[model samples]
Target chain A: MTADRPLRAGAGLKPEHHRHILESRPDIGWFEVHAENYMGAGGPPHFFLERARALYPISLHGVGLSIGSAGGMTPGHLARLKKVADRYDPFVVSEHLAWSTHEGVFLNDLLPLPYTEATLALVSRHVEEAQTVLGRPILIENPSTYLRFEGEEMAETDFLRALARRSGCGLLLDLNNVVVSAVNRSFDPLTYLDTFPVEHVGEVHLAGHAVLGDIEAPLLVDTHDRPVSPEVWGLYHRLITRLGPLPTLVEWDSNVPAWPILEAEVARADSVLRAAGEGRARAA
Target chain B: MLPLDATQQTFAHALLRPELQVPVAVAEMVGPTRERRFAVHRNNVKASLVATLAAKFPVIQRLVGEDFFEATALVFVERHPPRSPVLAEYGAAFPSFLGTFEPAVDLPYLVDVARLEWARHEAFHAADAASSSIGSLAALADDDLESVRLTLHPAATVVASAWPIVSIWTTNTLDAEVRRIGPDTPGEIALITRPDEEVFVHLLPQDADRLIAALADGAPLGEAAASVPDGFDLSTGLALLFSAGAVSGLLEGMSE
Candidate 1:
């Protein structure tokens, strides 16, 4: 795990709440920002990001690195990521495990990847390339996948563990994504979490997902628009209780509510971490 | 199973083309729910990119009603999905697309208005540099002034249009009332700059774009000023530039 991981609970920063967060100086553990938002040469995004960086530890997360792309990664994106990472020196830097670009077209979503030996090697090399350019190791988040691919290869966890071991990168275990993927794929969330490479997990993401279609076999979409779901919260608590509280972030990107709402989510995660820490201390 | 690259290529190809069948690879894996699951990715890609366009070109979206804008935008997205992930740089070709688009032919000014908005977007995110005050120009002698070269601020841009785009942009972006503009309205030159925190769009007198373009092309003040038409308000143009902090630094002529 990276030494710069923020162990407490944090909130994803939204543009709407930039002024409010800076003014109020909320007592949150840290702030996570999407790297794509700040890639512009200079503007309000940079201005507010600099101010926010001064007040809180920031985790730079990239949604567009396209690490799993077989056509290779997007050109110049790594340099852009490097610029943001260099500017912010974020406590932790991360990107998704899925590809969003193919044949020179950026799809703008975290599309899934097949877990094959070829993909594992490609992703590992891409992660190494990113770490080499940024001069620091980065964490790879498990994407909230909607569908699986037909392939004869390893399980998702095995692939991720191998990628981490090969590339020396850490894992950003998004619990909401775990629940979302589990429900959509008709798998047990607990079993998946039980097998996750928790030792390599440096951070955890808890976000709200939208359940659409049939009530019995709903398709869980990783919407990140509302408060964290109870199922996700339960998984988060279970993970923290066992993993001893990695850095947790509550993400609400769309239809964002007031700062207090997001702050409350962070507070809830913080309390969970505190309880887990207390339990550990009692055990000691 | 498809090769890794072929799998991504097939998946990506089908994502943009909804009419195509979900790849047999994905279909076979997810079973009956495959189409709905595949639609999730399709919806996400188009919706997010459309949302990005909407955010970048709000005035374009407003000028045409939301439905028209989105309908046209979907066509644009399919034909020209972003080549890069930095969405701020996505719609560089949109203004030109609007110009040739048959649906927008009635509103001839739509293309230029889109250009003006794109210019404002560019200026808003261009590299930040300190603007040199007009006080420096005052130091130059009358004869030396024409030879002096001024550096434009990095965030400054000149958007020349054949319609009253500045007013259109201003009215749409701000809380101002909708001022009626006619077909015969004279063209305006928009000077966009973000000297400090806010992006300012100032409508300069006609033909100011020529001088600004010349100056931006590394021409000295005299060379650029000479290229403009007679009766052109050099003072108004220079004043707008300096007031907006568009002038960054001055380089004395090499003739000296």
Candidate 2:
């Protein structure tokens, strides 16, 4: 469902900043939470979420749906997500286009899936199932990949477009993922974005990455532990310019800074969004 | 080309089991450096799972130190990967695993400490319930009290340990003050309840454990007190429950 108000720049909600958010009620456009964290029967997570929900729109960003698993989506996981979505009435619900669970074991990381026609059908069906079960269209995000599988039928963007078309789901375009995957696989981030179906992009994610290995053969890890790098910001600027200011989120999951630092990142994203909105208006 | 199911199963095997060769489908894509690139996923998966355990059991990690905890947690991760995608529910089998672990045998109290941490983790996320106030109980007629079963809040949990787990958990987590535990230290019964948004652990006194334990099991006030030692005071137990917000409701006509 569309938000009551236009979605703007936001940050990932963390327990460390829950009280600060509720007390300060900062000028964040909205907040997002990992749906798995709130899957428990109920305590502080629900407590803070209820308080935050009253003041701001929330997006339930799920990290554990394993939507690309070959075996199919877990009914139990979808049920839990539906429960949380119903309880919080999140403005948007999203999951990664990667699998974390395999053969009854949850690897707990968004493992990449090959973009094959068979895999495409599987993910498309799974996304459709999640949307039907949640009774709201879910947003699927592209994952950062360190390696690609051989014998893939299409590019990652093509797979996402097909999945969106088949499932009628929107996209959560994570710019940092684009930059990381591009650097790791030796491709241009802008080229990947050019092929991306921008019309289906409902939300945009901006986060930081750590450069690992030597400078000669660098690997960009989507660590989300620090401030957004300038390169990702550039890609974000490009994204909003083309896509016209979707709901952008600044995610700092690990080594999270204090409220002011995260607020600053959100502020940075809001400025880009405002600039893009202005540019779009001027052109119109 | 391998089917999608085989490719995923092989990939998962490679990530979790280093002995297995990198899935052939993945190897050919990245050319010669596929193994190292695949190791990134392996490292990320292991590190993320270890971090999840570390967050859930900070006391255990602190007691054992970071390096030891990570090494031990890696073993736990391999043996018991999460069944659900919810990382919060991942370590239900960890405390028991620690109990049987050979390396941690020296620290006999480690298992109980893990249990206490797990209990707190569970209480932290357990369902919220409106606690029964003393005023609510005051309205109950004296004759009906013996047969009325008091329901404990969903977040209420009692962890009984033959070791001084409460003192160990408190001194390790909350305080800088150092406390030593010897063989002669008394065992403890920790009552974990989330009175508000914060979960707190209180050491039960005398027979309060038996009484509260019984009450949690749907024992009425009189019968719960009867299960405790002689000279068990129902008023003291009731006061503790009310103060802790452990009692959620009174089930009328329900008795032990």
RMSD in order of candidates: 1.8, 1.9
Clashes of each: 0, 3
lDDT of 1 by residue, B80-187 (tens): 999988888899899999988899999888898898888888888888888988889888999889899889999898888878899888888875687787778888
Which docking class does model 2 fall in? medium
C-alpha lDDT of all candidate models, in order: 0.88, 0.87
DockQ of 2: 0.70
Segments in model 2 whose C-alpha atoms lie over 4 Å from true places: A1-7, B28-32, B134-142
The TM-scores of all predictions, comma-separated, are: 0.96, 0.96
Residue pairs clashing, model 1 = none
Error of 2 at A276 (Å): 1.8
**Model 1: DockQ against the native?**
0.65
